[model samples]
Target: MTASSSIGTGPGRALIAVYGLFSLAAGARATVQIAGRFQEAPLAYSLSAFAALVYIVLTVALWRGARGLALVALGIELAGVLVIGTASLLDPAAFPDETVWSAYGKGYLFIPLVLPVVGLYWLLRRRR
Candidate 1:
């Protein structure tokens, strides 16, 4: 096959794989939080669902090679992580409980923090 197609086979496949994992993980966590005990912490649970949606969108956009959607999702993910991370750090009381972006995704081995950076790079590379 061609070089571009090869990319879609190797690194591209890898990227999509990571995105898939995040989608599954975030989606499940959000589902549990929102369905199980959302009343205890609506803000945190809602944020979890939001984060899950973002991950799902990001995964789909990347797999479909929809550059615009991918860019939008990645940008929003970056913004969410930064804003939430800072907020959790500065005002823990405001959070009440941890969402995926809490402490910039420290709970997820900081992949939540790093994924957007890598996604942005991938999207930019695809643009060229």
Candidate 2:
């Protein structure tokens, strides 16, 4: 019921940690891929970096207890996963390599697709 408790207690911590890991993983992968072979699949690489940014924003917002910002970031993440996943599945030419959302996060054990859902649910449950 209090302010900080909503963000500091319960499942929030687990969610925050997971998001943090995802941020690092995606960000590092994007940076390496973009720097190494950006020309190979510019769109896919760019999308990878964008997904990393979304994960970072969501992680920070949640850590700072910014409910609205977290929600918005998670919304973007979910949309990105859906759209990119669908596109990658339907057409492989545009994304020769793989972004975080490729195949609905098939490469990442589908965590990319599920994370946003969990994040959104956590935000909603914490919201009064």
Candidate 3:
């Protein structure tokens, strides 16, 4: 397939690459946090693991050129970040730690908040 016609090629490749990196980061972080001290904050730890799973699904969807799946995953990611961010801010005691979306990914430099917007725009602009 030509580069322009495939989401996994060209610029989309960069997006996917970032997504892959995030998948690994979130997965490893969640694993360590959950395994070591899940009892400390079950909700936050579970959200971390869930965020990792979403990143994995989003990365796979983009790589495979599954537009619908990518859209859904990205949407969920956006909502997750917003909801989690707000909840954490409103109730600091509940979080007590960080999930990928906590504080809208302030811990990760807000990339998680922005990635989904870019991914959604890329997918929608592809004319697929």
Residues 35-118, candidate 3, lDDT per residue (tens digit)? Answer: 999999999999999999999998898788887788899999999999999999999999989999999999999999999999
Residue 79, candidate 3: C-alpha displacement in angstroms: 0.3
Each candidate structure's TM-score, on Cα atoms with residue i matched to residue i, is 0.90, 0.94, 0.94
Best by lDDT: 3
Give all candidate RMSDs, comma-separated.
Answer: 2.3, 1.3, 1.8
> What TM-score does prediction 1 earn?
0.90
Estimate candidate 3's RMSD in Å.
1.8
* lDDT at 43, model 2: 96
Per-candidate clash tally: 0, 0, 0
- Put the candidates in lDDT order, highest first: 3, 2, 1
TM-score (C-alpha) between model 3 and the true structure: 0.94
Query: Which scores better on TM-score, 1 or 3?
Result: 3
